[model samples]
Target: MAVGDPTVRTTPAVNETGEGTSTILQTRDLRKEFGGLTATDDVDLAVEESELRCLIGPNGAGKSTFLNLITGRLEPTAGSIYYDRFDITGLPSHERVDRGISMKFQVPSLYEEFTVRQNLRIPLQRAVESDVFEARTRELLDQFDLLTEIDEPATSLSHGQQQRLEIAMAMGLEPKLMLLDEPVAGLSVEETAEIADILQTIQAKEGVAFIVIEHDIDFVEMIADRVTVLDQGGIFTEGTIEEVTSNPDVKRIYLGEDD
Candidate 1:
């Protein structure tokens, strides 16, 4: 798909602000196994309210598996998952969504034949009061910079635009914490920066926490407030991007560096 599509996502300012230092999501010894193959290995993760945390590692490091476990796609083999005060260990995905958790996978999820506005309306229709549906739909359309494409079919949009649309749709559900997998994977560098900017804006204004599972080191560095590195089915280290990049173990063992 072409990257030149001009449907940039989001304009700044919804005039929203919030304050909190509580833990919104946490997992205690979270583990998932496929028979003898352990994918998520005793991961103890905590994402503070409104924090932007990124998980990055080489392929097969269990980043996706960890996401699945937290989102209720896979029941963990052992340990527990907690969201706020809820012990949501085995709750279904929709139940988690009702508790203000949502996820956007690497691929865009949109109604390909629907107009951009229609795509936004679908999720908003389900989440918002019926009297406010149209108003909220227009608000999201403007927020994602999709006002110009309000009438255009989603299938005709560039891949980058569709990614934005999908994310915007995810936001329509009013999630407190959103899990995004490789959100900028297919975009050009400029497009990457734009999406990162939009996310940062959302984080600051809406107090939304995001656990971004990504392998693009540069992209992770650009957007992550804090980072955790996973390796061979477990957390190898946790720190700021600078700290992780400079660690000799991370550099030599995973980052292909030789001393």
Candidate 2:
């Protein structure tokens, strides 16, 4: 049996449906610290295959730290991270991507000078034959609804459009699990809703799984299949959109209550 394998023994915690489900990413006693302060305190998060889990918290809630630990941006002071069936706690960022993991940061990270199509070609062209690369580029442009702006420089696109392009590039990696940090951070309501719609369509058609970190409640309600609430460095609670929203403690904490 592998160390900390769920297959060997059942976990005391059950899924949202109160049934055991296949998990794609899991952490045991995941922790990170800075000097005397603990950033992630014994966080145990489980994400099932194709599950859309959202992480939410006020500023300084450790949401970013938790993602960093999983993506290998930072090493944990103590814990183990499991992806699929392998132990990936010690893997680096690129290795994690090679293992079918990808991430989109809050800020847009693209080649602004390059056209949207060119940005995609930079990655796909390196892996596929010329014909395949061209086909993939066209497919991505259509899939992302960017055919009209295919040759336009990325900087010319609107904020929302830029966000979509970044996601499209990440999808080019054909990742199994995608981590997103505040994907709609600085967008208008319409823009945020558009992104949510695109995500739902992709999830239904392609079965892409995501672990998203966000502060926007409206955006969370639209895309979250399950919500994980973090407070002070640990997981406060997790549940469906309605469940988390209605929880008295969640309401109080989200409002910065003292009692």
Candidate 3:
């Protein structure tokens, strides 16, 4: 059995219909402190295979810190991280990616001067054989709806297109799990809705698990299979969207509502 607070089991690892599932990621007493300021406070999180989980919190709730720790961008002060039954606490960022963990940051990290094709080609070349590159790139472009701008410079695309392009590049790694930080930030309502649709399609078709951190409630409702709420660097509560949103305490803590 995986470690951590045994009380924090895979109850939330169920599908939308409430069928129990296995965990793909587990963190046991994961913690990080900067001097005396604790950033991640003994967080124990479990994400099931192909599940789309959302992590939400007010500013300073340590959402970014938790992600950094999981991605190996920062070392944890205490605790261990497990991915698919393997301890990955000490792996570097690149090694984590090599192990099928990919992250897309808040900002679109694209090659601004490179065409969409070129940007996608970069990672595809590294992940797949040259003989399969053309087929895989074509598939990614079609899946991301970026075929229209395949030859355009990444910077010339709209904010939403740029986001999609970046996601496509990350997908080039053929990851089993992906971490996305505020993917719809600054996008228009239509763009946001489109992004939500794209993510759902990808998750359903490819069975890739996603851990998304977003402040956009509507987008979260659209794509999340389960929701995890954080407060003061620790997991305050986790459940379905309805369960989390309807909790009086969650409203008070997450939305600053008066009791």
Number of the predicted model whose lDDT against the real structure is largest: 3
Angstrom error at residue 115, model 3: 0.8
In model 3, where do residues sit more than 4 Å from their true spots?
A: 1-21
Give the distance in Å from residue 42's predicted Cα in candidate 1 to where it truly belongs: 0.7
lDDT by residue (1-259, candidate 2, tens digit) is: 9955767764333322123448888888999999999999999989988889999987898999998998899999998887777778888888998878888887678999899989988767534678787788888778777889998999999888898889888888878888999989889998898889888877788888899998899999999999999999999999999999888899888755544
What lDDT is obtained when candidate 2 is compared to the true structure?
0.85
The sequence of per-residue lDDT tens digits that candidate 1 reaches over residues 124-239 is 87678989987888788788888789899999898888888888988998999999999888889988888899899999999999999887788888888889999988999998
- lDDT for each of the candidates? 0.85, 0.85, 0.88
lDDT of 1 at 107: 60
| Candidate 2: segments with Cα more than 4 A from true spot | 1-21, 125-130, 256-259
* lDDT of model 2 at position 147: 81
Candidate 1 regions exceeding 4 Å error are: 1-21
